[model samples]
Target chain A: MTAAAPPLLTVEHLTMRFGGLVAINDLSFTARQRQITAIIGPNGAGKTTVFNCLTGFYKPSVGRLTLTPPNNGGCFLLERMEGFRIAKDAGVARTFQNIRLFAGMSVLENLVVAQHNRLMRASAYSVAGLLGLNRYTRAERQAVELARYWLDRIELTGQADWAAGNLPYGSQRRLEIARAMCTEPCLLCLDEPAAGLNPRESAQLNELLLDIRGQHGIGLLLIEHDMSVVMQISDHVVVLDHGAPIAEGTPDMVSNDPAVIRAYLGAAEGEALPPDVAGGLPTAPPC
Target chain B: MLKDALAAAVVAALLALPLLGFRLADSQQGLSLDYRFAWVGYAAAAVFIGRLGMAFAAAAFSRVFQRKRQTLLPLAGRPSRNRKIVGWLLVAAALLLPLAPFADRNLIDKATLLLIYVMLGWGLNIVVGLAGLLDLGYVAFYAVGAYSYALLSQTFGLSFWLCLPFAGALAACFGILLGFPVLRLRGDYLAIVTLGFGEIVRVVLLNWESLTNGPNGISGIQRPSFFGLPFLAAAPGRTTFHEFFGLPFSPGQRIIFLYYVILVLALATNLFTLRIRRLPIGRAWEALREDETACRSLGINPTRTKLSAFALGAMFAGFAGSFFATRQGFISPESFTFIESAIILAIVVLGGMGSQIGIVLAAILLVGLPEWFRDLQQYRMLAFGGAMVLIMLWRPRGLLASREPTIRLAADALEAAPQTAGEAAR
Candidate 1:
């Protein structure tokens, strides 16, 4: 990636206020195309709020959220669109912090549902599909292929016929990512993809995220609490404290910054920093 | 178990205190209280024994059923091949019902009523089951369909065939109309709005005397004819169905014809629903049911998908309503009351939500069983209510709990590709 190439998404002065509280205030960042930009913060630092605004879940009080699609198709003003339009029209897909697979639906059906808009067009408003037309059958075959491909990628092929809720926790998390990928999103926003996972599962998640970025060339905006995953995999890191960015740079630069440590420790501004605490900031944050 | 029996005896004694101790009788002169000590004691004993028996049976049943599986397991794996066989058997039985040698007018009539409920259950299933929209006012569409047919036929002298589609269209229009305001609602709020909508339609029909004939309702609505021939006595100028068919005109013939008409209509509804369930929109419905936020994230427009469910469900209800009006030769607001909506909703829930075949079995059990026990008179509803409670207790997920996936990676897809001629030679 070159500096001259434009970023895929740009959030300029994004501010979201809920009543008297400012959840995300004056945030600006750029997620380069095919790059993993990690948003790491202490609890209640409004990391998820930034993802919400970019994905059109919440309208920012004052900001411009722009998404530049591949091939320069058009720049989508994400905040101006509805949540679903941001997904359907702007080609943005997301997974929730708490896993939100269609619990009663099968794993295969979950992936197929992610391709709903495309399959719907092939079905010609379902008339063709209902009539068992060739176009629908072809599209359907392709959909099943896509579902199977992802199933194998997630290593859940054996559980394809099982209800999504019946899968193990780690597999459900992978299934959610696979489901998001099936939407063919230009930008994937994941909220805490590594939550509630063992060390090995986190390592697998890192590999999966790296593979997604490598193969799909889709930009990823991640909100993660795990410092190891963020420090290991992130190309760019943005640190937020009290709804505003406190630090931004490569993971190495941001992790070593004193302000990032102080924010994480919840210390008051200008408070005397402990010598050992300041000195002990690891150059390489341990996983 | 003995403790439970003792508790039940105390509760029974409390219950028997008022009704068993004294009964209000309308004597020739005035109302009087009559003592029935022995009868009260007997009733109390019966209640005590019944409660004890039920508790013991339930304990024994759970002990047997739960011994192998202590944890609640997901019941929705791939439906077994056996289920497919059972489904085919059910369809065959329904098809052969009218042709059975022992079929009588009353039995056929009951079957027709049962099929009507089955149709209504399937219609409600789309909204409440597939789309996960709790539409309590489903009967409003039924009312709209019935009135559309009744008014069209009476005013314009339109035949049943013409009115049928008109009725369905009008009902669909109402469905969309009702769907708009509740687009953002879900669960209980949606249920409330739908219930209100159902009541509003009934009240409008009742108050609008000129249009719906008010409480008197529209009557003498013509029965559906076989093409241009009426199902009546052959006369000098009229061409009757029996006369055209060269058969004796028994009254039972008309009942049997009506039964087949409803059978065809109900079967059509079933087929359309089953087919639609496999389509993209159908999948969208189930997705929306599971999680609306996820549906939006997947690029599915919830409004359009939900509206389609509402309109489609209402359209079938409208068709059934029109059939109801024609079959009974009457249309009234009373017929489309909240109880009717409840019964239809009950059928859908008791049938296991989106299960098509489950709806049929539920309708037979709920509608047909009650009618068969009509000899119970005042206790019929009591028995019906008790049966419902028992069923819900035994199977909270309804009788048929399996869910068949809409799509599969067929085993054949994994097999080797066809060998080319050169490859085969090699």
Candidate 2:
């Protein structure tokens, strides 16, 4: 939470390819702890590919990703972990661009199952103990408590028993996020969390992002197409174009940068954002 | 109402068919009713009544309560102690029917055949239904099991009971072997591989004459006798089952005993499958079926989950296959063919995949109806296939599709549930 603390996630010259296509080319950036970092780009600019690499969905062709901590000592390389292992061992969890909530399952079951890894661990120990092979049901109680805590945090108390697929689209989207959060992630990567939102919903999403960062001290890596959301809520911005990073800076600095503007808003209106929003952006932000 | 009345009338006619030979015949023209046809008729009527009753009950109850009607059915409501009792009663009736005094000999035998197919349908349901993996070579495992029991029992003088477990084990081992190499294939490719695998088993059985007796098949196969007591042969001093009970010996007793054995086996298949569905591995199968990517993200090994589905499905086929050999006292390659697997798959599809009761109803309809229509034998399969297509069109998801999740949290866990857009952002 302090300036002296290292950034939570540091990416250096990450590159990826699909046969002849260079999907992510030399993308480098850092996601600092306790801040919402937005990665925005035109379609096919590899914003999602970068997210995929960070979450172990894709193996980068080149470069390293190191995540530090707000309260811990050393940084760890994220690229080495498998997708599920990354979530388990490194406390990294993510939501998809298209909602991946299990449709036949209930809303509550979706979240509870997110804590499946932990519950399984507990059950194994208890079974062994019952057979006079080992001891301790502490893990079981802890898993239930953790599941309960997140259920309260997400505010989905009323519709818990409803099948996830039956929930309204907006609610399904929220449940997906809450399911990811139930894993108690240190770094949460959300893919286009505000893509289909109305103005009011977008505003609400901004507040949630702030709350998530402030209260949990979790680093947020968000890939978004909504410029309003990216400009309003992101503490740091990394802009990509044609599978490469074009700009990285504080929100205001990146907003005013010609390359960021050209990549996102087109060359003509690159610098046309209202003055107040530009003035609020951080200057010379440390990584 | 008219349809119900007509259906009931048909049921009454079918029930009277077994006694038709005794009562309806006169001492002149010489026409008689077959007992097997009567059994088929009874089974068809049971299916029709059970289905219609469930549908009407569901609609009526839901209308009165203003809730989802589907919940009235078993496995839809919260797990109850009553379900266990109901399950046991159904099992008992299925076993005890053959023991009843008026049950026909040929009728019981036909019913046992129907139960064996039901077991096959249920087993195939695991692979195609639970795991969403299509397998068209299921009967290959049936052949492996049948041949294993026939070869081992005939060559070594092994008891049918002892050979039963060995057959299942051998079939399961082969199943696991099949599972290993083809674990990664999906959709059409997987189906092709399974189809080829089934044909391969049949070809092997046909070519391996020294062991399987080639095209002639292994005959003189032993029928399983209960508690080491053979059914009476009707010669002097041979203890007939009826004589043991101080009654007249009748062919019905032998048919009834085989009926009970198969009925027990079929019920065991159902119970074992239900228990496995509630286990961790079962959930994993469901999860993988829904989304493989999500399953992998949840730390499940897709290879292992898929393999388990294959092995378990094959094991059931083995059980059913060995039972067939014992019941018929004969074996042949022609029985374990691709058409057999297709029929099993059709039953699973028509029945709601993953639904135990649905499969039972579907099996009776698919297998029993045809035999009942044996007088119109050439047209029966055509009608059968048409019925399957119509049923599928009517219920694209299956007859009793799963509308609810198996694992879930209690009602109070939703205190923090996300509401309108305003709350989600914060």
Candidate 3:
């Protein structure tokens, strides 16, 4: 990605502490527009912590998170905003490592709820919707159309009326992405989007992420365990170990970095490992 | 299995022995131990038989449906065409009951009481059912409404209609006040705080004698009228509802009038709930209910959605409360105690949390049956508890626990709701 492409989200000197433990320390990264920036990390690497701070689920001990959407919405200093405002005004949308679809609602309703802010405005904060007025109806139809488009894109149109929880695990993953996209966010943060998928579903997820990055003019910040997804589709990759960036470059460069390998495989076993090695290292790639 | 059942019986007998085997009998001289060991044997025998049967049933059920249950969970809450017919039939019966041959003043009065509960259940459903906020202080809003109407009507000499909006507004303000502190809580913690809030409201009313009249609640409150005509006998100079309609003066006119008033209020509540479910706010309630974190992540404000639900639900409760005060021609803190909150909560749960039609059936079962069984007297509570236990065992959800989605998109989608299990357990 070119430096002149313009950054969508700029994180500066981000630090998060829970009591005495520093979960993330001095973490900083900039994700550019129309790019898939993957944060690949071992377990306990605080990838989700960074996403949490960016999404306003947590206020970092010290940090600045600036998200500038291409639509000329003012720069959102996310760390200072309320949890909902980060999404509402800053246009930052995310899906969870554990899928967080509105499980009781229908698939279509889930998508429609993603467009809640827009429809909420059109419905005049619900007075018009209560009266079933024309403007609200037109806006609601348009919201459904957006939901329908995403459903078709995600190939979930048939299950549009199914309760979201009842969907197959793979479909739930895809549907979660669709729901996030329905928000029309400038920056989408996905926490382990391919966590529980089968190989085929993982490939499909990679393709979907690629499609979103290539066509939607939206920035994608993904925390992925699937090497195929990260190495295949990501425009840039940031490798994290011990809650700090160990390597940063294109996916090929990060994959080839010795520090990244050491973080994952743990110093080739019995090579006099350091005293503070964060936590256990996985013996193999999760994928 | 027989040996396990025998062990359970032995434990059960040992537990019951102290309570049932020896009771302190009142004698002329003093208290003496009286052996009632037969009751202990009966208790042991019941447990033994129940344990054995349940064990056998569990084994059979597992053997039969172990694989099928997984596939069937999603199919449970679909509303079939016949069920819709049943719902409408129930409504029709409710609407036509006053004209029935057996209808009496007492029966209509009881029906009106049942309708109040139905309205309360619907109102509470928006908060507890749709938004998934378990409000144990809902009766506080109801009390607020009643007190608002009573105090305003008496002090200001305002008509019931004039005070109605004030009552609702006051209750809504109280709801928002309660909501602000409790929005950060969830599930059990939220319920705990709300439970305290209800008691606080009741205690305030009990002590604030100056404004509320304390234990001696404000009386001679104004009654609601039909449009501009009052529901009273036509005096020498004034025209009452019966007089205006040219019908003969009958005391039953007031009862029927009160019944219709509550019925309309309850129907309007149900309609509002129905319409809102299809709107953005209603959908937001459901979404927030599903997961607050997800809601915030998606740009829907959890605080606003939850507050709106609480306020709207409280507003309806206020309306019901105003009607309730006018209906009884009296008001007091005693009427809005913790037990009333429990009963309302029970109706919502017993009707299946988000199910609209289920509230009607629940109201009939929980409120109607008790009023009809007033002759049962001391045994009323026993029968009520027994019926609730039986229903929980049978349905474990509610009588008509069907949740059809407010809107649908897929062609020929299954009519049943997929949210068949969990959530309500909260």
Candidate 4:
């Protein structure tokens, strides 16, 4: 336990069951501010199920998922909250593995909508906004200013008015992240954000994620299938196979762990790790 | 071409043989079979000719418009630049319609009826179009509004103006009532529940005779006045609208006044919807429509957002219903049926989900033209359904279904973007 850093989110004894199957079992991890924690695994490893439980999308059969924002902001038991309350009150936001932008709305509008809770207050639940009050205008301008800042971060300012769905796939992925950040979350969870990206796009995603952690000073929880991304940027790593953790440590430690290597390679016990496997488990994506 | 046409003719002849070729005729002794093979031959020839014509038309159309289609198809999802002019033209037409030489009281009255539907379509546009909730029982709120106004006005001798807001509020309350049970439902399930809700309201109105006067419906509903001045002729020292204006009182005055009133109300509905789309709640509704899951993750409370949409949408329906009651001076369960809901929804869908301008055109096409063909009686519905089918084939997204951004940043803001020059390198 490092007393130097304060934990932002802590998941303990997390277990999820779907009828006869346990999708996740006994998952424990702590994510601190300004850190990126990545969960990597083989297929059906309950990586996304962890995300579901933390974001309140699914109720874990047994677990305690807690989020505590910095500076005594609030302590929220996420598993007890509704999905929106987790985002609105607990300040935890997520992007889907399959990109889910408001495809028909403009990119800027997509970001603006993520700030709905803040503006809803300024608008007094829409009555003041409907009446064209000056307060609402000021609030809306600030929302736009924040949205413009994210657009610049992702280099999407030029295409802010383009319909979100009309953007290229890489742009859509970045836009989804920007939209998630627009909610000003204490912890941002990204689910396979680089799933289909080419090597260059993946590199750009690494840059953006690093910038977000360093500049915004927020904790990030990542579920990544791409070994290159998990290895290069993640501060700490957790590996799971068949709903149970096999290894957990720094990326370097996890990559060299015999159990993680065996889980990735499905090899016989004591088998030698490949030259590349020692750097990134399974050496996937050729990056 | 000839070979394909021959095949079509053969298929048509086989299908028509049983229906057209032979008939059972009652003869003196017993039922006898009578053959009319010539009728089958006629059917085959008709099919043959139709197939040939269609083939020729297809060839000609493709040859003439293939290049145009390529240029146009990519831009189909965007709102056209000239839509502003088209919108202005529509506005002008609506304003000038009652005063046109050809627009007598009969014509103006029909136009007024059409505007009522136009208003209803706009109201449903919020729920079904922007919010993406498939409401099939929207008319229940319409019925609620109508009944609320009828009962209040009769029981307490309330004026139409005094009861309008109450009718809208009452209907909105009912909307929230329906909204709560179905917040978790979507697509077909939501639709089924709403459809059932519509029927339930109609049935309640039908059987609750003591309160609703049963199937006989409430009658002698008060007509709306211009503020406090009724449209009726002057009595004693009190003056009607025309009498106050020192103009001749034609019976047409009342019709024209009603037309303007609905026109103003419809415009108010349009203006409010247009303004709200730029607000947080409206944007939230659109976002909710686009992706409900994404909405949840973005801190939008799905239930509250959906309920607000339902209540606001029903409020508009209630307003339209009150106007409907006043215009007809009668109300009943028969007025608010599943078909009425279907027609209002059709106007929203056919107008291209969220397009305000499209709703106006759809209302005119779906409601106005059908009235013009009222002479067809039962066949009018057949024509309406056929026209809708043809329209779906032509523009599956609804005519003018431009999925345009509800709001665009000003040009100067685009200019202020620092990456505009850097984008080329990217």
- Candidate 4 segments whose C-alpha is farther than 4 A from its true place: A1-3, A267-287, B1-81, B234-237, B376-379, B413-426
In order, the Cα lDDT scores of the candidates are: 0.86, 0.74, 0.86, 0.88
TM-score of 2: 0.77
Superposed by TM-score, candidate 4 places the C-alpha of residue A250 at a distance from the truth, in angstroms, of 0.4
Docking class of 2: incorrect
| Model 1 vs. true fold: TM | 0.92
lDDT digits (tens) for residues A87-188 of candidate 1: 998899999998999998888899999999999999999999888999999998899899988887887765676678877788899999999999999999
Q: Which ten contiguous residues of candidate 4 chain A have the minimum total lDDT?
A: A267-276
- Candidate 1's residue-wise lDDT over B1-426, tens digit each? 778777877787777878678989999989998888877678778877888888888777877767534223332233457767877898788888878998888899999999999999999999988998999999999999888988898899899889989999989999999999999998999999999999999999999997888999999998888888888886569889899989988888888888888888888888888888888899999999999988898889989999999999999999999999999998788899999999999998998888888888888889999999999999999999999998998778876655788876564442332223341232
Stretch of 10 with least lDDT, candidate 3 chain B: B417-426
Candidate 4 at B235: error in angstroms? 3.5
True contacts kept of each: 0.61, 0.22, 0.62, 0.68
Q: Candidate 4 lDDT, tens digit per residue, B1-426?
A: 999999999999999999899999999989999999999999999999988987888788876646644333222124466877887887899999987999998899999998898899889999999899999999999999999999999999999888889999999999999999999999999999999999999999999999999999999999887777777776666778888888877888889989998998898888888888889999999999999999999999999999999999999999988988998899989899899999999999999998888898899899899989999999998998999987896678887776656555556666776444444344
Clashing pairs in 4: none
Candidate 3 regions off by >4 Å? A1-3, A267-287, B1-8, B26-29, B50-79, B234-236, B410-426
The candidate that achieves the highest DockQ relative to the unseen native structure = 4
> For candidate 3, what is the DockQ?
0.47
Relative to the true structure, candidate 3 has a C-alpha RMSD (angstroms) of: 4.8
Q: Model 2, residue B273: what's the lDDT?
A: 73
Model 2 over residues B1-426: C-alpha lDDT tens digits?
447745765766666565542344444568653345655566666657765775677567756644433453322124445545655776777766766776676667778889999999988888888888889999999988888888888899888899888998888888888888788788899899999999999998999888788889998887776666567665365565665677666666777777778777887788777755644456667767767766655555567778888988999889889988887788999999899999899889888878777787788889988876888878887998888877875567667665445544543443344344543333
Q: lDDT tens string, model 4, A33-56?
A: 888999988778899999989888
